[model samples]
Target: MKKYNNLAEGPDGFVYTARLPLSSATLNWLSCLIRGHLKKIGSWWRALSAGRIAGIVLAVLRCDQRPSDLAGGNGVHRTTVSRWVREVVGLLAARAPRLDRALKKIARSGGGVVLLDGSLIRTPRRTGTETRKNYSGKHKCHGLLVIALTDDKGRLVWVSAVRPGRTSEITACRHYKLTAHLRAAGLGAIADLGFVGLDDGGPDADPAVIKCSAVPAQRKARRDYENRVSTLGAPA
Candidate 1:
């Protein structure tokens, strides 16, 4: 990777550049990390090189572009792009254990706090039993539920398996046994009001390990206190 040096001042008083290169050190480290898993197998011609395949995956994930749109822009068939995406996903899945260990090391070394939250990923509408399972009353859309745990710096540490959209955030956490995992890792977690009961000092709850802010009430002072707590608990 090369350093970016083409920055220019625009009319709007903002500096702009065409390309930003990754640090050579970082690129080399990443290359060495994935080199073993990205080995070539059968002697067959490939339309896109390994670099291009990685670029396609990053664009789709970071830019949130559709496969068809990316295919058109890259002058490749949609099926080819889709296949590359699946291949990259499988490669990452296979390396999940290594990734988890790395994150655990960081958490333990730094004694960093973890932030737990649930998000809904939109999906196409479905019929029959699927409709009931994937419909989110809160978002008024069909989606999948995913619980993510991030470090205090907002870097993702772990993500739970997808659940139906209708599942509450707290329910999903329980289903995934996230509390035990957090306890085992010896890391504290901060969650939003949606996980109210999680830190309520119940027989199964560990208030010290998992803390959550109280939901805002009708009174103005109560709402202000809740807001302050939320602000304090939010990850940097």
Candidate 2:
């Protein structure tokens, strides 16, 4: 991959931002497109100033700021920010480019590679949500199964969240199709062992091929590495 030792400057004499794989102009264009969509969705823009909502969403995405945390950022109430976040998540999930295209752009390749993995978000204990043990068997938590597809650089292209602890990785993945951008870029999906199930007479199952795990040595390090590799092998 070609590496840029320093950030590039734009035609408008503004310094380019670091960490974003896309160029400044491209990012601006994409943000504008997103804002345009938000405007059309029942005047979320009218409910709150466009700048405030945009700022709140960007803050949440960048700093993990919750709606309650925005009480001091601007005069906007926490409830307003929370509503914006929900609307933003829903819009982005439906309108964002497919994972494959975003990956190909970042990698600067004709093809794209995506790492599909799940994350857990803790849910309120009082609610009737499912709870599960930590993989390490340390504690219990309730949360959704989130599968994210990211490029080699770990930039997220797509994310899908499901009910707290309702299903395993393979089942959750079945709800999402390969992103359109990824499909256009001839992208490939990679996942862990929990996903290695046989096809269920579906067309989406054909591209994936599972490789079985080998017996592991008694040593903990070797056993862990083997387990990781086995999980990374494609699902059947």
Candidate 3:
């Protein structure tokens, strides 16, 4: 197999073109954040440029490229790429605001309500008793249940901790004390039927979260709803 740069790489691999999928500004921001974090810990040097490091993490995160491929491209061990990914992800997670804090911010900004929804976050299946615990009868797969709150414009504001996928979304909200928090913040939530009973529409319940219109109880409708929710969290 012969290799060429332009029309073809050869019988072994074909040449292809792609866009970065993220803006230059986003890449630069990630690089700066990583650099600042390293500096704060008194680390001085890295084999790859901060921008390049950001690119590697983004490729794996955004493009779903494999770590082994990324390692080969950068001439580093696969473990090194994994480590960088862990580091970057941890840093970003730490910076995300807590649910209460985000709610307060939205309230202060004069926002009336937030959109709340639950998703079945996909997870790899493991053998044993754990499988039954993580398995969702609705989706018929193993995953975690996660509640997410988004602004009216669909921007993510907060996400709940992972729970067993078998847990009902309405039950998950109660566990999180979401209604109390929303009331305290003087905010409401608009949720899908999964959270139909999240708020009782009582007169005393100020700024009550409203549930969307109910879907039919037919088995096909139920399955369709579950399928749509599962797809929202499935990896590309």
Q: State the lDDT at 176 in candidate 1.
A: 63
Model 2 per-residue lDDT tens digits across residues 32-52: 755787667655545556554
lDDT of each residue in 40-81, candidate 3, tens digit only: 998888878889999999998998888987777677779989
TM-score of 1: 0.69
Clashing residue pairs for model 3: none
User: Over the full model, what C-alpha lDDT does candidate 1 score relative to the true structure?
Assistant: 0.65
Clashing pairs in 2: 100-182, 101-181, 101-182, 192-231, 193-231
Clash count list over all predictions: 0, 5, 0
lDDT of 2 at 3: 86
Task: Give the candidates in order of TM-score, highest first.
Answer: 3, 1, 2
Q: What is the lDDT of residue 176 in candidate 3?
A: 88
Per residue, candidate 1 scores C-alpha lDDT tens digits across 1-236 of 99878657554343222222444464344344345445555424567655556666666765666788767667789998898778767767766553246446655566445778889999998977779999999999999999887776787777767899999998887776666665555555767667766653357653423444545554665565445434443222
The local distance difference test score of each candidate is 0.65, 0.54, 0.81
All-Cα superposition RMSD per candidate: 10.7, 13.6, 8.6
Measured on C-alpha atoms, candidate 2 has an lDDT of: 0.54
